[model samples]
Target: MDFRPLAHFTAQDTWLNDPNGLIVRDGRWHLFFQNNPHGPDWGNMSWGHATSPDLLTWTRHPVAIAHEGPEAIFSGSAVEQDGRVAAVYTSAYADGRQAQSLAWSEDGFTFVKDPANPVLDRGSTGFRDPKVFRYGDSWRMVSVEADERTLLVHASTDLRSWTEVGRFRDEPGTGIWECPDLFPLRLDGEELWVLVLSVQDADGSRVVHRVGSFDGSVFTGGPPRLLDAGQDFYAPATWTGAPAGRRVLLGWMAQPTYAGATPTSPWRGAMTAPRDLSLARVDGSPVVVQKFSPEVTAAFSREVADLPPAALVRCGFDGDASWEFRAGPDVLRLAVEDGSLVVDRRASGLVDFHPQFARVDRLPLPAGTTGFSVLLDRCSVEVLAGPLAVTQLVFPREPFDELRTGGSASARVFAR
Candidate 1:
């Protein structure tokens, strides 16, 4: 099957993983990612750059930060400072030591490593993935202590010097925490802090998040919850300087079980389509609501009659809704049943890559959600329903382009 997606961003002839330094500057979106320059498999990690005026069409740039000595450039965040773009990332050393590093770009395409590299180091073996943001006149960063399962916070006046301020302890989980991100979401005239982190173990990886309050130093939260119910969403990053003062996010759409086993040669991984994030009241409690960005929706102005293998479709319904896709013997079903969003891929085709790829994943929808969007590609499906979104990777032995719907709903399909 042809696995190329029409709307999602994928690196050309290389491997792409966790999103890094996602920021909007000068009306363009700069997306830096954890890339393996060597081959389709994961190795020789560096920061690969791409710029898009609209999220639909991406222009790939050269490797911004090449692999240095024994250290590989890991995931981090980006900010616009003093009319220039600065990237703070984790440098993973070959000896198992990790430290925070800095790089700056004037054009947002080419980056230069700082002379005083390794800006912050805790001398801990598990410290990495620095997420930097502005707080008052100083800059704040959050890095994960993977071995200890804690988030270490630091403050810096200058990007070169940093002081440890506070730490966030993680709740019980499978493995180490990676790619820690802390941001504020406004809900009911109150701003709440949302912490996102990825958990990895021998089995696979998943993203978990917490909604709470964060003072200048410490983050106080009760417990964490799963960010996405689907199995393939991981290592998500939110952009700082987005248009119209919006918080946008993109997640890596692959899992550890069969990430390297996909049939897409010369390119290993792709990103989930960009989603606009906001806080909403779900059953009287605040939850993160993810919807397709306006930029993505605008790209699908031309409507088509049927759902192509690669298409963008939006569905609206009130009480109950069900959508089905079939190709030969393979079938995939999506439904809102009993106030829950269910994605049944048991018969979606070609599940031999992993044992858990052929199961049904369900997530509770908001109390009054009546509409949603579905972005379907050849090998994956992303569903944005009310306050929740799911990204799942699938493989069909044959391509499926037939779509059917039930209940009081209308489907508008678009192709690029």
Candidate 2:
């Protein structure tokens, strides 16, 4: 049940939170993260970097950026500008106000602050976490402006002088849309741009992205589309393609409450699988779907079942177990009872966890109940149940990794 820690990714680490700059340079994939050196809590947020030629084999680099600048250097993006790498970020100052700052890196690892510190700080009290991009002849910035009620878009040609271009309200009538991301997407053969945010409303919090158009000066678009069904996903941002291509994405896995909550490991909070995104045929709508990165599939030590639709198969994976099964509808399910186990799979892709965790006192099933492709990586289980994904942990806290059912138990794969 033990796992070899991912090279750039950690399991024995404390709080590896936000996915910072995710981009491809020189035919290489670069991943930067906001990591807390402290255990499971959001503290000193720094940019930790890693690179990969192929996603499977990751190479960890230095602690790219630390908490030396105004308070903790929050999340931001890096881009190649003027023949050098320049980063734009929301700098958290000690007074609790945010200022947008620029940094330049010639080597892509070491970043030096721009001579014009706080280049565009317009006293947007909570102005932090700046996302900058190049659009045609101008550079654009989408940032959280007011402390709680506003979002702002600015236009600048030199990443220095900034001019307010658009304003959006996220009041209760709307929602507290945290990270405002404005980008372009192709849907059903239509050329369109989308504005997205990490939103919190009366119901709860979710990742929301919307369609909007820029008519020379202003943005006009519909409301956001609630993207993630998982209760745990948040702070998603898009990236420019690698070598040169389409739009990509990166998101932090840590929720506000889950920040620093899990136990310390070689890695703490991890991203959901790195996915290749595109406007595709999703149940008839032009929705975005994640085609699993090859690296995600490469992690499977034992691939038990690759069942087609409505196929069910069970096997006794006695003792300690770790596996990833490509399930179908009814979907795959695995249960544990009094340290024993059960697995249920349905035909249309819904998963039940009650029987799977019966051994753990048969915890009541939460609402929005559905089937899932249970990814059991040691004590970590990621239930990918369509849009609603849930991650759970089970630490044995005993002298064995084996489930305590008369000393052993069994698990199998089933397709309803």
lDDT against the true structure, per candidate, is 0.85, 0.56
For candidate 2, lDDT tens digit of each residue in 111-193? 88787878877765667667787788998888875346566788898888999888776434544657767776676677666
Against the true structure, candidate 1 reaches a TM-score of: 0.94
Residue 281 lDDT in model 1?
Answer: 64
| Model 1 ranges off by over 4 Å | 172-174, 201-203, 317-321, 406-410
* TM-score for all models, in order of appearance: 0.94, 0.72
Q: Candidate 2: TM-score?
A: 0.72
The local distance difference test score of model 1 is 0.85
Q: In candidate 1, residue 116 scores what lDDT? A: 91
Locate the minimum summed-lDDT window of 10 residues in model 2.
398-407
